[model samples]
Target: MRAGDTAPILAVPLLLLAALPAMGFADWLTLSASGLAMGMLLFLMASGLTLIFGLMDVLNFTHGAFVGFGAFIAASVWARLPGLVAAPGLAANLLALAAAGGAAALVCGGLGLAFERVVIRRVYGAHLRQILITVGAMIVAEQMSVVIWGPDALTLAKPASLASSFIVAGGAVEKFRLVAAALGLAAFAALRLVLARTRIGLVVRAGVEDREMVEALGYRVRRLFVFVFAVGTALAGLGGAMWAVYAGTVTAGLGGELTVLLFTVVVIGGLGSVSGSFLGALLVGLITNYVGFLAPKLALLANVALMAGVLLWRPRGLLPLVRT
Candidate 1:
């Protein structure tokens, strides 16, 4: 499938333009920023799956487990460092945020390594088994989280610097959301850069083309796969941590609840394409907010409708990396 089309790129601006007439300029501004922020968070969650799917070709149902793990882990970090998290100073707030995100990523990545070694390595080519086993693992992980964190939802407060919204052109944008968007954008850029301009990316792509040939070239494909899986899970965890901050609460089922949306993004963006996931996320986010505003009753079905429409128009998605 072609991956260079610019048509899909216009979806965001077009949607923004279409929504302008329905609300005031200020409202539109606020909603636009909100949608962009939402899209970024979704991107963070889905991007890892794209990488795993593209290179390793594994259907990892346990991806969501990492998200819940990250959120809970970050919550624990905040609880342990109450002073840094609650401080009004930016430096203190950043330190706390970094610690939480870093810890979540590390823990989730470690879990991914163990999971891949114990379970995933055995079911490399079996899609059905991958789905079933990973789903089972996800359930087990969720239950374990409940056992460790307790069954009650845990409240998470943003650092003082990010707890409030700032007004720009009469529109209010939460500081946390802005930071989340920036983080997501940076991740996207970095992933693109690494994949397109690095030797590791070259080897990965070469492996995707011919595993035996790459192995003949003395590259350890299996080790690379493990690394990719770990990175994917780590990204999911980081995304989950950011999401927890945004939602202000953490629950064991938080990740499971978002599974459908995450898959929708993966499918809509074209499985295995990071760029596609980014665009798909933005599309989902914008459509959701717009539909929520215009027809409150249809909010639940907005994503499905959008997915259906996109599929009808482009069966392979906007920028599929591989033929589906």
Candidate 2:
């Protein structure tokens, strides 16, 4: 990549430096930790969409449904295992979280398979129809959630072990946020490893570059599509589960509310680029936290401003994988 190409990566460090003078070092550290945690959550929510959007070429508005489902399902897990969730033991807390995340992934992954077969298969290459049908599906799914879980917002308290903060360099960093950041980094590294070093990754990348050619090579591209879609939704569900834990609440509309931010991350990071999405998410997370703290009123507009600015400076996003 050219230096010009890598310039966008500097935005995070520069943003960090820019904020130091505005607050005390400890305050800055706390906010930075918060921002990092939020960014990772955003990345978790948006990363799967990036894979589907870039690899599948399908416009799936129902992606939010998976997120909502993930959140509610995870909440249900915690509700059922109140003992484990509330236990002061770290092992019990970790078990509760693992179960919740696993359930979310499993349920959402199954839903993704059904979605790919019933809805997405028919609308291949048709953006408008894909948008309409998927959105309608999302609405239906949301209503189903209401029927099953009710319309009330559900709260997901962090497990006892992750509920407190520890002092780090005179700043208190929430243990949960630190865990989120670590998980996000692990997910990113895993994705990079799979996409760059494995045979399935090679095939997926090839499919992204030339689907017809892959099919012609007898690679069963259709199955590949289904696999991608399933995995994408699963990731989104996992992200949703984590987000519910982070935010302490999950509503029927949680996924819908996050859709805008997910798209912003996808767009700014480049439509199909995971690495680009990572950077875009960090920029957004930090920008929102800093601006929300510095200028409360602009919080709503902070992400949009960042998106617009990035687009004006690099219309193709930080690392656009596919040329339009």
Candidate 3:
């Protein structure tokens, strides 16, 4: 669908007229920024899958658990940083937030590596078995997190300093929200640099191309597999941490069945490419954010329709880097 295919284009003029000149521009700009910010977060979460599928050829179903785990950890730490110290303000809160996110990444990464070593290794290249195991793992992880952290939803607050919202065109948005978006974009750029420029990334690319060959050439691909899994888990953790701040809650199972939605992004973006995931996520994010403006009932259609159209046109995905 082009510009003409959308009702938003038609509605924009009328909405502008209704709002007057200055109000319309401000409103549009703020909405667009929010959309972009949301898109960036999607990109962060989807990036993990891109690498996992790209390098390992594994369709992990339990990836979302890492995200939920991260969210829980972040929410708990952010909301309770004062308890950790006599006086917890902006600096302490930031440190706690970082610590929470970092700790979640570590914990998730460790679990990922262990899963890779203990169970995933046996499946090797078995996609079907991997699917079964991953689904089971997801259920177990979700339930275990609930048991450990309980079923209650918890709020994640930004520090009073950071939580403040700045007025943009008469509307206010949280500073933490903007920071989270910027962080996601920065992470993507860093990831691109790592994959394209570093030795670790070169090996990752090589491993993606031919795991057997990479192993046969004496480069322990098993270690690489672990690395990819850990990295994927870490990204999930970061996504969770950011989500906690954005959604203002740390409820269990936040990433529960959403693995399917993430997979949709991965497939539509391309199975094994970072750039593809980033592009797909941004598109999905924008659609999700702006679709409401196009008559609330037809809103969700934006994401679904965009995905369907992409898959229809590119069955292997938009940037099918790998034949899979």
Candidate 4:
């Protein structure tokens, strides 16, 4: 990695160190673990947006709608499969959860394809049009969800096996958080492998760097863009499913509320950069948690403050893509 590449990475430890002086060791440990888990979840959701922006250069304000819809879909799945989710066996609970996540991904992936074809295609290269149209689409999606789900907040219970906490170094860490962290790591590793080692990954990266060149090389760039959008939406769906369970409730506005945070993460991570998104997420998560604990009144301003600081230091974001 280049010297410039180390800035974002070192930021994580720096934030942690800064927090340590303000809290007790045990409190810090617990909060840090929770922060990391939250960050991982955010990364899972934001990574797709970054990829979509990086490769397709489309500002998909409707992305959060996918998340809100996915949460509802997964909630429905859990409601229908009570026997599986309520089973005492961990395997049964896990299987049921996996099924719900898969269902969300499949449904949202299909929706993303349709969204790209019908809504996004017309607004290509027009940032203002894209923003207005996609925001409108998001509002419509939220209303559609309210119509289908009755505008009531749906509750999602974690599996019995994952509802408790484990003690580590005298600090209590929630099992669900651990699961979330693990899943986030897996997603990151999988994305890295695919983007670094596979042919499709090569084409995607090439398209991101130079779309005209990739098209000139005989690859169908439009089709590839559609697929990337699908994948990005699928990831959003998956993250929404996980988040619904974490928050223990779902509402049509859930995605709308997250939209701000998601954009903050994408910008701080650097537009179109996954690794930057991951690091940016961690920083946001840590800062929020630390601030919430140290000064409850400023908790809400934590992310805004962090974003301002990062932008001041790196205007393009922590890990901006290099364009020739």
Best by TM-score: 4
The positional error of residue 119 in candidate 3, measured at the CA in angstroms, is 2.4
Question: Please, what is the whole-model Cα lDDT of each candidate in the order they appear?
Answer: 0.87, 0.87, 0.74, 0.89
Stretches of model 3 off by over 4 angstroms after superposition: 1-23, 83-93, 322-324
Clash count per candidate: 0, 0, 0, 0
Q: State the lDDT of candidate 3 residue by residue for 239-309, as single tens digits.
A: 88887777778776788745765887788777887767766776666556555654568766666787888
Which lDDT value does model 3 have at 217? 82
- Backbone clash total, candidate 1: 0
Tens digit per residue, CA lDDT, model 2, 141-255: 8899999999999998789999999888888899989888888888888888899999998888777767788878889878887998898888888888888898899898888
Model 4, range 1-324, lDDT digits (tens) per residue? 246588689999989998898888888998999999989988988889999988878999999999998899999998998888778788988898798889999999999999999999998888999999999999999999999998789998788888888887777789889888888889988988898899998888888788888989999988998999999999999999888878889999999988888999999999988889999888888887889889989987889988999999999899887765
TM-score of 1: 0.95
Models sorted by TM-score, best on top: 4, 2, 1, 3
| TM-scores of the models, in the order given | 0.95, 0.96, 0.85, 0.97
Error of 2 at 33 (Å): 0.8
Report lDDT (Cα) of residue 147, candidate 2: 96
Task: List clashing residue pairs in candidate 1.
Answer: none
- The 10-residue segment of model 2 with minimum total lDDT is 1-10
Candidate 4 off by > 4 Å = 1-3
Better of 3 and 4 by TM-score: 4
